[model samples]
Target: MAETREKLLEIKNLKKHFRIDRKHTLRAVDGISFDIYRGETFGLVGESGCGKSTAGRTILRLYDASDGEVKFHGENVHARKSKKELKSFTRSMQMIFQDPYASLNPRMTVKDIIAEGIDIHGLAKNKKERTERVNSLLKTVGLNTEHGNRYPHEFSGGQRQRIGIARALAVDPDFIVADEPISALDVSIQAQVVNLLKRLQKDHGLTYLFIAHDLSMVKHISDRVGVMYLGNMAEIATSKELYENPMHPYTQALLSAIPLADPEVERTRERIIVEGDVPSPISPPSGCRFRTRCPFATDICAKVVPEFQEYKKEHWVACHLYDERYADQMKQ
Candidate 1:
C-alpha cells in the first residue's frame, strides 16, 4: 500500500551541523534518510537533543543544510535561493511550532494571526473576504467566530495551538511539519489536539512530519515511525511493527519506558534500562554512536558502523546485532 502512494518528501543523507567554535562542530542531524508518503503522518521519535527538531527544521529549509538533499515534491528544498522561490514553497509547506505562546505574536489579534498567511499569499481580495475566511478557519479548528476578535493571551495553551494550526491551514499547504505540537498542552488536551490534527489531515488531504518524544501518541497518530539516537536514525518501521517488535536497542529501550495501561501486563513486562547519558554530538562515539549505552554492543561496534538496511519486510534498522557479519559475537 505504501509503495503505491506518491512520495511527498524525500530526505537523503541529510545533515545539520552547528559550529560551536573553531575547535568544535555539533552534528545535530547526521545523515538520516527517510521518505514521507503523501497523506500520511510520519512520526519522528527520540530522546531530548536527539536531533529530531533540528532534522525537521532543516527539512523545512528554516535552517540551511550542511550536507545532503531534501526534496519536496521532486524539487530540492535547500536549492531554493531566491525569496520568490522560497515564498512559493512556503505555500506548499508550512510548520506548526512547538511553543504556541512563542510562535504566535502577542500583539496580534487571533483574526490577524490566522489571516496573516492569507494576506501574504493574497488569498483574499477585500477586507470583508479576509474577515469571513478568518471566521471560517476559527470555526474549523473548534474555536468560535466571536473568539477571533480576542487576543492570544486570553486563550489557553490548547486554544493557542489551534490558532497556530489555523494559521498553517490558512496557506492551504499540502505538507506540514508539526514540531511537538502537543508537548506543552495538558495531558487531557493533548489527545484533543492530536484528534484535531488527524481530522484536519483527512479534511485537507495533508501530509505531516510529526516530531515528538511521546511514543504512545506517535503510535496513535502516525502510520509509520522513525526512531533516532544520537543524531542518527536507529530504526524505521510501521508504528505497529516498531512498537511490537523493535529491532534497535535504543528503540527497544524507548518503547519499554512507555507505561502500559493494563496492570497485569505492566507488572510482568521487562523494562530495558539504558545506562549512561547520551554522548555529546561534538565528539560522539567512534563507529556506532549508541555503543556506549547499548547492552549488546561488542568490540565490532566500536570498530565498524552498521549500515542502515532493511531487516524484515519494510522494517529497517541500524544495529550490529542484526548484521550477519557480526552474528557470532552479537548473539544473546
Candidate 2:
C-alpha cells in the first residue's frame, strides 16, 4: 500500500498561455489541477507538444502563469514574492531540466556549476565548505571528485545527466520538477538514471514532479500518474490503477501503444489507434479538446466540455463517456 503523505504542492486551474503574432494565443497548459504529496513521484505523461514540460515549468514559476495559482507549502508561487522570499522558495524547490548538455553551462566546470546554487543561496560558509559540498554531491550522483574540474562536453550523456541531478540536489531541495531528464539518454542509460533518482529519493525523502512522454518509465518510477492531451489533462490515478484500468479514451489509446512482453498478448491485443493528428491549442476544438478524434464522440461532446470528475476512488477523468448521466447511454 502507498503511504498517504501531506500535500507539498497544490496546483489549481493553472494556465500558461503564449501570445502568437500579437493576435493568437497558444494555451500551453490550459487549466490543469493536481496535488503533489510529500515524498511521492507524480508523473505527468503526454505526447510531444502536449505541454507536460510547460506545466512543469509553470509549476516551478520559471514561466509566470497567465492565470491560476500554484501553492507550494501553502504559499502561492505565482503571486508576487520578494527577492528573499523567491530565493527562499527557490532553495526548497529546484528543477532538473530535459537536455543535460544544453542545461549545463558549457563554459563552467562541473564543480562551479553544481556549487552555483550554494553560492547564490549562501549555503556554504567558506570556500572549503563549498568545495567539500560540490565534491560530496559529485560522489552522491555516482561521479568522482576528479571529474569535477572537467567540462560537460567531456562527459557521456548519462554522466551529464548525473551532473544535472547533482546540481538540483546541491541545494537539498524538498521538491524537484524533472522535465524529461532521461529522454535524451541511451536506452541502457535511462534505467541507470531512473534507478539513481529512486535511490536519491529514498535517501533524502524527496518529492518529484517527473514529466515525460514515456509511459512505461513513468509507470516504473511514479507513485501516481496524470495523462495529458492537447494541453488538457485527460486522466489521473495511481500508477498501478491507471495502467491496470485506464479510464479516459486518450489514456487508453496511449497505453495500447505500449507493446506487451508476451507474444500472444502482443499478437492478439487490438491497439486503440487515435485517429487524426492532435488539434492546435491556438484555437482548440470547442467543448472537449479530444472530441475531434474520440471515436465515441457525440453531439454532447462537441457542445459541452466534460467535467473532470472521479468515476472511482482516486481515478479522475475528463470525458463524456464517464459522466454518470451518460453511463446508460454509453452502454447502449
Candidate 3:
C-alpha cells in the first residue's frame, strides 16, 4: 500500500483495449490515469468515440481492464475480490447510464427498479420497510409513490432518468459515475436532471465522475475537468485553470469551439478548427497521438511518444510542446 495516493478514487495507468477480429485492437481507454478527491465532480469531456464511457466503465469494473489498476479507498479494484466483496464494493460506487429509456428494463415497475439494489443487498428487512425505502427514494428524485407501480414505458424520458437516479441512490453510493446521464432527455429536462444530481451531491457529500460533451454543462457542474482525445488525456486541471489556460492543443481547440453567449466575445474569440478527422484508435500515430492533426506537430513528435506528466501542481498534459518554446509564447 503506497502512501501519497490520497483522494477517494485513483486510477493508475488504466488501459482498456478490445481485441477486434483477434488481429486489430481497438484502444478504447489507453493508458489514462487520474485521481478523484472526495465529494468533487471530475468531468470527462471529449467528442464521440474518444472512449470517455469506456474509461468510466473500466473504473467501475463494468468492463474489466486489459491492463493497469483502479483504486478505491486505497484498495486495488483489480485484485481478486470475491462476489461477497464486490457486492460490498457496490455499496460505495455506482453508475447512472446515458440513455434512461434503454438502460431501464421495460418490464420492471418503478418500485422494483429502484428497490432492486435494496432487495439484492438485503438492505430492507420486510416488504413494508422496502416500500417505505422505495417511496422515500421516489420522493427524493421528485417522482410520486404512485408512479412506483408503473413500468418504465409508462413514464416520459425525464421520469425514466429520475427512476434511474433513484436506483443509484438506493445503494447509498459515495462515488457515482454518471455516464452522460442527461444526453437522452429534452434540453429543458437536462437542466432539471443536472440540478437534481447537484442537489443530491451537495446534500449527501457524493463524489461524481460526470462524462459528457456539453462542455458548458461540464464546466458548470465540475470542480475539475479533464479533456480526452483519442483515448488519451490531453489535459487536466481545475475548471478555472483549465478554462482560463488550456495547455493542450486539443483542449484549446475544443474550448475555442464553445460559443460565447455575448456576441462581442464570440466575435473576438478565434475558433481553432483542426483539419482532418480523428485518427483510428486501432492504429493511432506512433509518437504523439495528436500529431496527425496537431498544428504544432514536428518531426520529433512522429518518433518519440510524449510522456503524460505534471508540469504544474494540478495541471497535467501529454504534449512535448510544453517545453521551453511554448513557455516563452505565454509571456508574449
Candidate 4:
C-alpha cells in the first residue's frame, strides 16, 4: 500500500549541526534519509537527545540544514524563496510543537491565535469569515466555540494542545511535523490528543511526521516507524514489523525496554540490556554509533560505517551483522 502512495516529502542525508565553539560542533542530526508517504503518519522514535526533534525541524526548514536536502512535492524546501513564495510554501506545511504551554502565546486570544494563519494567507474574506473559520477549527479539535474568546492560560494542558492543533489546521496544511505533541501532557490526556490527530488526518487528508520518544504511543499512531540513534537512522520498518521483529541491535534494545501489559509475559520475557552511556554527539563513536554498546559488535563495526539498506522486504537496517563481508565474522 505504501509503494503505491505518492511521496509527499523526500529527505536525503539530512544533517543539522550546532557550533559549540570554533573547533567543536554538536551534530544534532547527521546524514539521515527517509521518505514520507501522503496521508500517512511516519513516526520517529529515539532516546532523548538522539536528534528526533532536530530531524523534524530540519525537514520543516525551521532550522537551517548543515548538509543535504529536503524536498516537498519535488520542490527544494531549503532553497531561497521570495517572501510571497515562502508564505505560500508555509501554508502547505505547519508544526505542532512539544510544549503546549510554551508554544501558545499568553498575550493573544484563542481566536486571534487560530486566525493568525488564516489572516496571513488571506483565507478569510472579512472579520465575520475569520470569526467563523476560527470557531469552526475550535470545534473541529473538540474544543467549544466559546473557548476562542479566552486566553491560553485559562485552559488546561490538553485544551491548550487542542488549540495548538487547531492553529496548525487553520491554513489547512497538507503536512504537519508533530514534534512530541503528547509528551508534555498527562497519559490520559495523551490518548485524547492522539485520537484527535488521527481523526483530523482522516477528515483533512493530512500527512504527519510524528516525532516522539515514547515508543508505545508511536506504535499506536504511525503506519511506519524510523528508529534514530546518536543522530543516525538505525532502522526503518512498518510499525508492527519493527516492534515484532526489530533488526538493528539498537532497535532490539529499545523494544525490549517497552514494558508489556501482561505481568506473566513481562516477568518471563528476556530483556536486551544495552550497557554503557550514550556517547557525545559532538564526538560519536568511530563508525557505527551503537558499536560501543552492541553485544554483537565486531571489529568491522568499529572500522567501517554500515550502509543503511533493505534487509527484508520493506525493512531497512544499518548494522554490520547483516553485511555479507562481515557475516562470517559475526558467526565466529
**On residues 1-332, what C-alpha lDDT tens digit does candidate 2 reach at each position?**
55566899999999999999888999999999999999999999999888999999999989999999999999899888889889999999999988988999999999999999999999999999999999999999999999999999999999999999999999999999999999999989999999999999999999999999999999999999999988889999999999999989889889998887799999888899988898998999998999898878887787788888988999999988878787765564
Superposition error at 270 for model 4 (Å)? 1.2
Candidate 4 residue lDDT tens string, 1-332: 73588999999999999999999999999999999999999999999889999999999889999999999999999999999989999999999999999999999999999999999899999999999999899999999999999999999999999999999999999999999999999999999999999999999999999999999999999999999999999999999999899999999999898898899999899999999789999999998999999999888888899999999998999998888878887785
TM-scores for every predicted model = 0.98, 0.97, 0.94, 0.98
Collision count for each candidate, in order: 0, 0, 0, 0
**Residue 161 displacement in candidate 3 (angstroms):** 1.0
Quantify all predictions' global Cα lDDT against the true fold: 0.94, 0.93, 0.90, 0.95
Mind giving the per-residue lDDT tens digits that candidate 3 earns over 243-282?
9888898898888888888999987877898889989999
| Model 4 worst lDDT run, 10 consecutive residues | 323-332
The local lDDT score (0 to 100) that residue 186 gets in candidate 3 is 91
Q: Higher-TM-score candidate among 1 and 4?
A: 4
Candidate 1's C-alpha runs over 4 A off are none
Best by TM-score: 4
- Clashing pairs for predicted structure model 1, backbone only: none
Q: List the residue pairs that clash in candidate 2.
A: none
RMSD of each: 1.1, 1.4, 3.1, 0.9
C-alpha-based local distance difference test score of model 1: 0.94
Error in Å for residue 248 of model 3: 0.3
